[model samples]
Target: MTVTNADRESLRHGKITERPLRDKPGYPSWAIKLVMAVTGLIFALFVIGHMAGNLKLYMPAHDGVAALDEYGAFLRTMGAPLFPYESILWVIRIVLLVALVAHIHGAITLISRSGKSRGKFRRTNLMGGMDSAATRSMIVTGVIILLFLLFHLADLTLGLSPAAPETFEHGAVHANMIATFSRWPVVLLYVIANLALFLHLFHGIKLAASDLGITGRRWRVVFSWLAALVPLIVVAGNIIMPLSVLFGWVS
Candidate 1:
């Protein structure tokens, strides 16, 4: 093998070309974005369904209680014969849990990478105002929402809260809701948590839309409206329940 300048240059170029290929083999940026988008949308759908179901509290007490109970029962009995009691609900819960984990992981990874890339000396923009505020606070709001979700499950789903109904019957959802929200402190906590949820949801929707390649000059207005409206609707529906209870409107 003759050693020449040309051979040495070719070897150096080959090694340089292989460096990027060997840097890392992991999920690509687009894959991470897609995971975040898909998981976010799934979680959003569950929230919407939950809010809609909770709205049954507005039906007159006799009807509302029964209706809410029936709704609870229906969820448990879904896919009966084909699946055991509550099987469908468990499936949905599992799916949501997986999605939630994936979404959080993706968000954390992306946020960490972004922070490292931007460094600590990045300039601030006063003009960003609410938009910037919402974007920056996503992780904080998300954490609050997760904590609230755990508390909610303890209070309602598991009926393990000290404030839970005396009997804690399975299908007595309306009564349980009224029981929990009747207290001022619970109501206040719910209101604050829901505010965080609204903010998180609004920004999440917009970010997900952009991630899914649904952005451009033409789609900007539509995405903006949808991002705002979807979160508004979900939060409004959720907040009204506690407010109605607190105000004696839905007793």
Candidate 2:
């Protein structure tokens, strides 16, 4: 077989190219960003709903407890007859759990990749100002929020924490909240955790928007305001409830 110069050139051109190590076959960076974005949005919605529900504590004592308790019952009975009691709530819980895992995994993967690519001495300060800090501290805040979530569940949902209310009631969410937040230490913990949550959500919303291609230059300012506003509202609302309980405003 005689090979011509043209044939050699064609063969050379047809050789498989190697991609960068980080771009190897697995979940691509875009896919990971998508997962992070979607899961973050889910969590954001949940936070908003949760904060709104918590604000029910501001109602008059008799009305507030009854309203909060009824709200709790409503969640459990969400799909009665067609579905078992608490089935919908459980389903939501499972979905949120999956999202949480995926979000964490994606975040860790991205951070590791970024750290390796940028090397140790790269200046992260060039990214932005406050937004950069929020972005950089995402993992820190995320871990804090995760720990706080476990404590929150133990303290309120399961009544398993040493700090849990002395008297546990099935549907009395208002009473439970008051009992928990009435303690100064618990109130302080909640405030700190919520501040972390605020930072996380602030960066998360902007990142999600950017990931989803919502970053038209004209719209950037709008998105930035929204990112800041939404988390502030949620955190403020949440902080108010605990502060109210601690100060006897809601008692």
Candidate 3:
């Protein structure tokens, strides 16, 4: 099709009458949502499961790694390794990996452009509606969360195996939780990370809602509240798990 002046005007207002979205780069809300929907559902479920697993701190033998290791074994036995749930968890894990990557990709793209679009008047002082803290510090907080995840997996999941003649001994989930969290340094790190995560969610989630086309009359507010609340709870919950141990609630 040949370009016409009329077609250009319509495209400027977000109409599909002349052009399709792929040819454009301005705030691909649909792409943001595609990333959100693809990743959001399963990651949400993981968040809940993660919280429950930490709650095992409230269990008996809650003093050391033994409790966590036991729970981990119980979970493994219950999942697809046993029958029904194993395949499901693996599929979810793959989906989660993709979603996380895509979500981050969309965010970076959007943020980078927003920076270019606002070049001169870009307020180093304060935003029109955005809080400066959130706008200024996303990269740092995100990197911390990424680092924490790696260390977490190494210490808990990878370190679970006992050092012997290649025997897979039961892990000490309880002891480990207690030991890891009870340490002042670890808890401090968690507290700082969770706080940053809280701020990130406060901004990113509402942006996600808008990106996902969930911005309705009242539904947006409801979801925005839930999004903020959910992260705070989980982040704080993780921090508290260790705090409890440190203060002798577990041990």
Candidate 4:
């Protein structure tokens, strides 16, 4: 008796399984998903931390230095005398870049493989419209987030051209934020990007949970709420900052 691909799939109940790495020509789908899950979690944690740090924009300045500025300085000088100035920050940036590249590679590869595997027949749409839509929009939302990241880096971190306001000042995080968000267009851009971030985070969290094997009913329910709540908090925290700056509430 011969077992067909359908027989194997049925036996597996559509669950993703890993094959021995030695037998594969390239990284397997499960490995790609695991890479995406881990990298996505890294990004999710970083954004949450970043959003919390940005919230210091609301704190009162001490000795003429904004608390947000202090936070920014702390990030650069973290691991201080034990390490050279900005070394820790550079290390973090390098790690984040590597993760970003791996995550993107995994997404593109999985997408290509999925498309190729679907050759002549459409898979049964068991997950319904919302999940299906989110699955489809993954690439679009991912691209939006990617563009937003580059713009954010240029506008704030590097203080580079048109993205950065004329009032942009190095090491003046609070002031720079105020100056940047004071522009309606910039605020609008931030609003749109954060909205995209919200969608991306929401779907990505749930997907990552599934990828990581959270299939128990109770756990899935818990993750569903978490998937929504985490992104909501992060996006709300981030979106409010620019809005507050734009509205003259923070400055």
Candidate 5:
């Protein structure tokens, strides 16, 4: 049955005038969250795979390079045209790109609204900042990690010269990684990036857990610690492998 204009007006002035559920899952807020979670998990898998592959660096040079070569070959074979790596990694990347956009858009939206409602204010330094230092610091460190990730892709994914790449290194991914990480500067950058990564994850993981309805009072502290610890282990694994390469401990 169609409502008359009078009925429509009445509804609009009452229950129908209530605020929309933009804060709900899948509308905008929680949907971006789901995307973030999935992309994050996929990224974790990549981290694990990389760490395992880099474990080769813990071996002697000839042995390690040989091991790296084997892993690289395996990846290429699997990534060619159609394979799990092809669909999975590429899909993850694309989804992550989308998720990132959504996440950033939502953040900007919320932050802007917050600022508009609260009005502009100034803090001379973080010591005077309204929130905790870590929260303020997250933005800065997160930007650093973003920059590092872009540079990482340029050096490795784009196959730029790495001070030591044979002719076979054209399609040879692993050779380029070894050549790059063998440098102390690159390793140093990676170490700094990992520190930033830890900061991002330390705050982010807990935030995500809390948002996803896992906020039992008794369990929250435990989950928060686990959230922080897991990423520390993963990022530490990444940092150690590159350092191992340059220190002559591995290669």
Candidate 6:
């Protein structure tokens, strides 16, 4: 006596159930989810550290270089004598690039598989509808953030024309940020990107927690608060920078 999907659905009464995972010829859903969870955690840590470094721009400059500039220099020259200048920085960038690729690939694969299955594997709603919008719009927000990242790299890292400030100077982290944010349009772009990031991070942290099996009943409330709080603090730290520069506080 085989249990058909229809029989299972009737027994479940329209509720989504996690049927025994079929041996799909491609990547398994669980593996994809694990990749996303791990990579997302990596990104979360990176963003928090990056925001902290960005905040150093507010500290007073000495000898014509801002604290943020010194910080940037430190990153470039880290592990010197044993390692060449920028070797460690490049290694970090390569790791991030690999993680970014894995995270994006996992996201796209899950989205495709979910659409094909049509909620066949959806688990019980752990979030209890707290972030349905963010949950639904993860890929959309991810794409927006991806575009913003490319634009950001061009603006700051590459110092490209039009995207970068007219006064763009390599290694002049503080001055470059001020010059870029002095323009109203650049400030507006950062604000919009940060908004998208807020939603992405808010729901992503919760989902990652769920995927990683951190869903004990006793700690659900605490986890939810932390998921929201982390994104809020990150976004606040990021948004304050451009606004401060645009309003002449950082100059």
Worst 10 residues of 4 by lDDT: 16-25
lDDT of each residue in 1-251, candidate 2, tens digit only: 56567655666897543445555737788999988999999999999999988776666546434677777888999988899999999999999999999999998888888788788777745778888889778889999999999989988899985958787665778778878988999899899999999999999988888898886887878878889999999999989888888888877
TM-score of 3: 0.71
In candidate 6, what are the lDDT values of residues 195-250, reduced to their tens digit?
A: 88988999888888788888797677776887899889999999999998888887
Worst 10 residues of 6 by lDDT: 121-130
Candidate 2: C-alpha lDDT: 0.86
Residue-level lDDT tens digits of model 5 in 1-251: 56668666777778465566444434454655665555555555566676677676444446544666666566555656656544655665687677566655655655555565566675455554322554677668767977887778767766555433333255455566667777788889999988877766666666666657777887788867766777778788888877766776653
Residues 1-251 of candidate 1: C-alpha lDDT, one tens digit per residue: 76577756777878434345233428776889899988988888889999998887776556434677778888999999899999999999999899989988998888776676678767578548657878878989999999999888878898885746565665678788888888888888888998998888888888888889986877877878877898889988888899889889886
Model 6: colliding residue pairs: none
Q: Whole-model lDDT, candidate 6?
A: 0.87
List the candidate 1 regions with Cα displacement exceeding 4 Å: 1-22, 61-65, 163-167
Off by over 4 Å in 2: 1-23, 61-65
Deviation from native of the Cα of residue 172 in model 2, angstroms: 1.9
The most accurate candidate by lDDT is 4
Q: Indicate the worst ten consecutive residues by lDDT in candidate 1.
A: 16-25
* Predicted candidate 4 versus true structure: per-residue lDDT over 219-241, tens digit per residue: 99998898889999999999999
Alpha carbon lDDT of residue 145, candidate 5? 74
Q: Candidate 6: where are CA atoms >4 Å away?
A: 1-23, 119-130
Measured against the true structure, the TM-scores of the candidates, in listed sequence, are: 0.85, 0.87, 0.71, 0.87, 0.69, 0.86
- The TM-score that candidate 4 achieves is 0.87
